[model samples]
Target: MSEAAYQEKVLEVEPYGIEPIPREERHGRARQMFTIWFAINLNVVTWFTGFLGIEFGLSLKHAILAIIIGNLLGAAFLGLTSAVGPIAGQPLIPASKRAFGKIGVFGLSFLNLVNNIGWLAVNLVLAAMALQKILPLGYHSALLILTIATLLIAVYGYNFIHTFAHWMSIIIGILFIIMTVISVQNLPALLSQSAASNGEFNLGMFILAVAIAFSYQISYCPIGSDYSRYLPENTSGKKVWLASYLGALTVCIWLEILGTLTATLGMHAGPMDFFAKLMGVFTIPALITVILSIFPVNAMAIYSGGLAALAMGIPLKRWTSAIVCGGIGALLVSFGGGQLADTYKNFLLLLSYWIAPWLGVVLSDFFYYRSGLAQNSTTNGWAGITAFVIGVIVSVPFMSSVLYVGPLAEKYLGHADISYFLSLVVSALVYRVLLKFRSAAVPVKPLQFEE
Candidate 1:
């Protein structure tokens, strides 16, 4: 292939697949991360996560606190993962090959691929619902439209994803501002309810609120670096971290608060009803705004999912993998159109189960056992996979969900899930300890500087 073919074109499908982005071709600044992430989280799902805070029985004040705290914690990890992108120059799941070994990473890769599909279903469902409001299309037809639109962006790959998000952030930002201005009328309803439940803040409910929000934000961590790998090799990791952290943190908290108020105003109805009531004739416009915003997030899920499938040794080209993922997501939406509220909550909780421990392994490998990440030998990292498995096993007793609340959560923690935290801490500590006995045959040199 000609060298010019390697140059990322403005209006072309991204030719690159899962390969590490070359430094010579790398472009963009860390701050661009701000727009991409901010745009991605503007959808109703993140808003619904906040509404869940109230649904879980926390006071509005407590829910907002939980939203802030959860986003703070989750965004930190999100930032940490994104910061490694320019240096690692590989897709997030592929970079894990160093820690999990080529074989062990497959399990994690599979988990990631599952998570991506679930998210794709989630975002597409949200968009389809919104699309159904404005267009003549039914839910299935709207879903079909969204599936094709998102697949195009994902197949086009990196540069297009970034460009799409940057513009969406500005457009969505204005639209949400209008919605928020109209939403101010509902704030009194939320505040009044807050005063009633304000003193009865249940610790279990509060923790659950934080966990759900944290889980949602941290859900982005696994795919955080996928977009940033195209940045210049010398990109400042700190700036990248800050950009991603603030971008997600800002919009997430904003939407969650707005969602809480919407829920309160709707009473027996839901947030969407609240939107319809509040906006009156403008309801169609609001839905259109929502439909437009979903593409950025759906694109991210499909794009990263394609990479995750490739990382797991799926023998297809990147674009082909995106097609498969989009098809599966559309199929999932067919079965999941009803019971969205319960389905979405359980989905968020389940996502935390595998991702937290996986985070433990990746963070340890990238930061503490830095040498392993730079090494080409995937067979040298069994210690990481071992520790990761142990962490997940240990966390099983503490798992809490409507699906199955673990005994430890019921017996001791009042059914508030702390398993996510336990998994991360245990995996990190164990991996650090195991590193002492673990040795590779080749002389190792830690990656001390950015790529």
Candidate 2:
């Protein structure tokens, strides 16, 4: 009743950096492991540290709305993809190939590459800023230190990261608790501030905020299955599903709520300034907590980037890939990655355009078209491509702002979150229509299952 549809024969596995697991060892228990995995991955540091909700929306309510909507939608997407993880026993990039086609995976990869690189760069600047505060070094020296530290973490690979997360979580969790306690004590009045004081309560801004938050992490969450794959073959998909859903929802709320509260309390300083204000007397512990929390998460980013590069046939070891990519990210930071906010906005729009449809096609293809939910043969189908193109085109008018082109455009057209819903609708519709013509295409292969 069960068989592995994809052959174990490694096709350029060296290049892809994907070593197939022996069939017998494929599944595992999801219990505490998934929670630990999810907890470590929560990585709310970037989301909060950057003042994204406040800065982007220019209002507390706007920020809150973005946070709430973004996390909810993102979690929903993660749930869809994660369910496929245990069943198929494949990582995100590979499973996605079924929808995007082999070459089309590049479309996803390219957008992901840009997004990750941009994110990595932003963090690099952030790390540099943090280091510069602690030390007397110039911006250049600080950036160098930031790059080297991030590289060291990245080179050590996942085992090191897992350990780092376990220990760091204990420490950071304590610090976060302390910080929250402190904030609540001093900023008691923040609770009364209106979320819509700056027009954040309006429908457009509210929806946009949610769209931004949702878009920010869609690329990141798709790869959750890659890490979750280490579980014992007997692991239930429900465990993975719960872990992923709760993990995203919890962190998004944690970070965003804090941010909204912080904004309301008038701590709306720049990133480093905000940290300085909050960490006043306990600067050392605060810095320690921040570094420990951010380092591993950034390492994971570079690690994933390297793996993706390897998967795309780059002749680099995983560690080498990490070092190379981490170094590049660090350099971007050193060279004044100050344009990160702008980069993020544009990237979000572009990504939303590409991914909304890609996701629609993937979900539609897997849940509706392909009966084999897990363990299947791979096919680079046209369904995803058609959806992707349609999504991008439809999002064009809406995404036409400074983020995509330049500052001049933003000055003229102003920013809006219209791209979010537009792309999703376009992608969903296009995918459905494409499925009608997909009959002549090669039938998707089902996963190999063992009886």
Candidate 3:
């Protein structure tokens, strides 16, 4: 069967992998992005990222402000990458191959491998923890169950994921809205707490809070276009961009603020556990909601990772690649579940460090060199790789992590990590300069790829 025929049914395994989607196979409304992304962020991880803002020493108001600013910036990057899908008709990293050659994109594949596996492990561990709360299920048992459940959806591929996300978006959105109403009761106690001297805003920490939310949302940029490449080629770029921006921005802010409210109440526990406990008589239902939510978010991670494998020339189908990723993620969960809160925070930061520089090159190629967007070739890509490396090297000194704290971060940023922002700016500037120099010498024309 042809790719489109096999992929027409939701349950039929998808045959298209990293190859440019055949136009006949292309289908989906741009509005689906809004629901897909809205459902994607409706998970414990998104909530916890927001909760970290409060934990980062911000008052509820300051944390909310940081979240809004951070998400606004991050979601725009996500939308831009996602918009590339309909134009490029390939997975995100593959769409990027023109900027970075086929060989050069392997670096992206490696980074994506780590990013997806790390996030899948984190989500699995959290969902397992929630499952344990739902009953007396052992952590390992719950982890294994969720790992299988999440893998099934990922392996089932794009149509399945889209259909699954559509219904869950509505169902989960309503449940959370009800939960939001209940959460407001916890807010009155915060007025006195906000008046406390400890509520004084710390600049470094406030910026750090913004960076986390920014990193958490924009980190998806690497894999984002994979989800939307199936949209018709003529799909409105404005609609595509708006759907991605609003869908992710709205839910992420809502959940993060929701997390902020719960943290300010002196709840000392993980996000799922805290929410379950705070819900009082609604405990069972709340836990059930969390348990049900594990698949949508984690499936996206696994699905994108699967495509990254194909883009890297891995000799496996997308479904098979998803299984490999699932296995690795399960191993991560088994070996590292200690000090999870700290691990998750650092993981979010580490993700942005690489992605920012990478995105800088992509956005520059797409918008600045508009003609370059029409190119179907993957060249040696020295310009992009060089800019990418230069971006990372220059920004390392500004990076502050437990693994390594740059002198600049220690001396001036109060240990806050702003490496992401630095790399983004530096990389774009370097790449554009290189492009200008290259173009001035040679009449710039698109290079076509040959088999």
Q: Is candidate 1 or candidate 2 better by TM-score?
A: 1
The lDDT, on a scale of 0 to 1, for candidate 3 is 0.80
User: What TM-score fits each model?
Assistant: 0.93, 0.81, 0.92
User: After best superposition, candidate 3 residue 2: deviation in angstroms?
Assistant: 6.8
lDDT of 1 by residue, 1-451 (tens): 3354645565787776777776667888899999998999987777666787778877777878988888889889999888888877877767777677877778778888888888788777767767766778877888888899889899988888888899999998898888888778667765786676655768877887788778778888888888888887778888999999999999999998888776665366544565577777778778878788888988988989888898888899988999998888778877656346348646655755888888898887777544425455446568878888899999988888778788988888877888888899999889878777776533345445452
Candidate 3 stretches with Cα past 4 Å from truth are 1-3, 6-8, 336-348, 369-376, 439-451
Residues 1-451, model 3: lDDT tens digits? 2545753589888888888788888899889889888899987677767777778888878889999999999999999888878877887676776667777788788888778877887778777877788778777788888888888999989999989998988888887887778887767776567556266668888888888888888889988788888888888877888999999999999999887777777778766668766888887777777877778988988988888887788899889999998888778767555245357646655655889999998887776544434364546777888999999999999887657778988889887778989999999999888877654323344322211
Best by lDDT: 3
lDDT head-to-head 2 vs 3, winner: 3
Residue 363 local lDDT, model 1: 84
Task: Output the TM-score of candidate 2.
Answer: 0.81
lDDT per residue (tens digit) for residues 1-451 in model 2: 1354322222222122344444554534454343444455445453463255565555665566567767777777776566555555556665666567778766566565555566677666666667667778887777677677777765665445555555666677778777777766755466456433556244544555566677655655545655555445555656666766776577667766776677665665667777778768876666656655667667767777776666566677877876777776766655444555446645544654566666666666666534433333355556778787888777766654334632322444345566656776778778767766766444454333222
Worst 10 residues of 1 by lDDT: 442-451
Candidate number achieving the greatest TM-score relative to the actual structure: 1
Residue 111 displacement in candidate 2 (angstroms)? 2.5
**TM-score order of candidates, top first:** 1, 3, 2
lDDT of 3 at 109: 88
